[model samples]
Target: MTHALVDSQSLPAELRPYLDGLVRRTLAVCGRHLVSVFAVGSIALQDYRHGRSDVDVTVVADPLIPARALRELAESLAHPALPCPAAGLELVVYGADFVGRPCGAAGYLMDLNTGPMLPNRVSFDPADSADFWYVIDRSIAHQAGRLLYGTAVRQVLAASSERDLYAAMQASVREHAGGEGHLGDNRVLNGCRTVAFCRTGRWLAKREAAQMIATSEQEFRPLIETALHSFQHPRSEALPLPSNDVRTFLAWVGERVDEAATHAGIGDPGSGTYPDG
Candidate 1:
């Protein structure tokens, strides 16, 4: 079993130590045919917080690593125990063929090389970039970009920007929402698209106007409400969230937006300066 560590430059300085140790431990446990390991998600992009996120590490190996082996690998990473809170460490496992398809924003995954029973290298397209503008505009986008893994995770981020990732997310969303109910699928799709476009517009506004938004509410309620209306569902199902659940999700996202802006140190939208007219 050979292991290739992701370059260090891709991870946030704060996450590197934990991630490196975790990778080493994972290798020690899964010494069975562990071909290579790479870094994915936020930390790979160099933008994670010490307390706000989980590290994303991608482990690629021979086919069928078994769920049991994967679980053991997770336990091993914490063998000596990680310094951060126990709740924060998470391990996500995928097949050498896990790079299935690009459904939504997660982008499509394609095989980079051929191998015996499984492929070793794969590519992902995630939404990012100033042109794309969704990367840092949305709170989720901003948070997702902060991930770190392996000994040298930075190399992956060096080749990728938010723009290259735009498709990966789209792919993931589509896959999640797919199935029999056309209306149900479309409803979820609308919500996802609205968020995606809103992030894009927000990015544009910040770039061109030097302000976060125009006609601002404390959050995105107004925009979400407006976009929700664009879907042609009967008024009964029109609110997006079920009547029982709408308020809760909205309130949750509302708080998140406010909190995210504060953390980034973006003061309230600057008041337009004008002489009395």
Candidate 2:
């Protein structure tokens, strides 16, 4: 795999102070119970649109707090604006979802879903439904430098990278597609393809997630038709097409990469594919 070159100094003046303050406040509020806090989602990736994005922050705490309550409280705290340059800000507390919850942000395009009590940032996976793994993987592969909790975040990152991501995807497919809830079966298979591609050095983990996020229901469905055709994986069979058209989707993602590269002072991975998604 190609190691991406990045200049950590690329952080924007607009984001630095806010992100730093977030870390300090989080640790102070949660105190000893706080395991760690890190930045993920769009902000860390530097893809946030000026008027459309909110800083995505995750805090891991002991005693496993209820995410709903945490989200509500956080939203209330940030409701009047947290004195940041971004249009808005939202904080999400992970862990404590018994009956499958919204995977990412409540009203936003992404969710930080994952298992309970563990701390790390991630993306959404229809197959595993573990938002934790998704965020952790994404953080390490693309925008982890934005992380705030130092050692705690580092431990999680080390563990995730130890295993082959393709293997993880296969396990997710077997467990979700061949095992239990079928909501994201087709996604599982596609995830498998993604993992395999990355393993073979054909794709980066960040690029893989971007491709999945960029995939369209109309044109991409046929690609995962066989996997979704089955009833065993009910969830996957039911995933509908995303709202945005292919052109819009690709443009959004393109802007994200450019913004991220600029903010992080990293090379922008050009839009790889925009096939009528």
Report the lDDT tens digits of candidate 1 across residue range 1-277. 3323355555566655666676677677667745456543334334333433344445544456665665556445542344543114433343433333211222212112111212223232332211122222222323332333332323222222333333323332333233223333233333333333335522221112112321233353444444334333432343343422333333332333333334445432221221111
TM-score, every prediction = 0.41, 0.40
Q: On residues 165-189, what C-alpha lDDT tens digit does candidate 2 reach at each position?
A: 3333333333333323323333434
**Cα RMSD to the true fold for all candidates:** 15.1, 14.9
- Each candidate's clash count: 40, 21
Give the range where candidate 1 is weakest over 10 consecutive residues by summed lDDT: 268-277
Model 1: residues with Cα > 4 Å off, grouped in runs: 1-4, 66-68, 85-87, 100-194, 197-277
Off by over 4 Å in 2: 1-10, 46-49, 64-76, 81-84, 87-90, 95-145, 150-152, 157-277
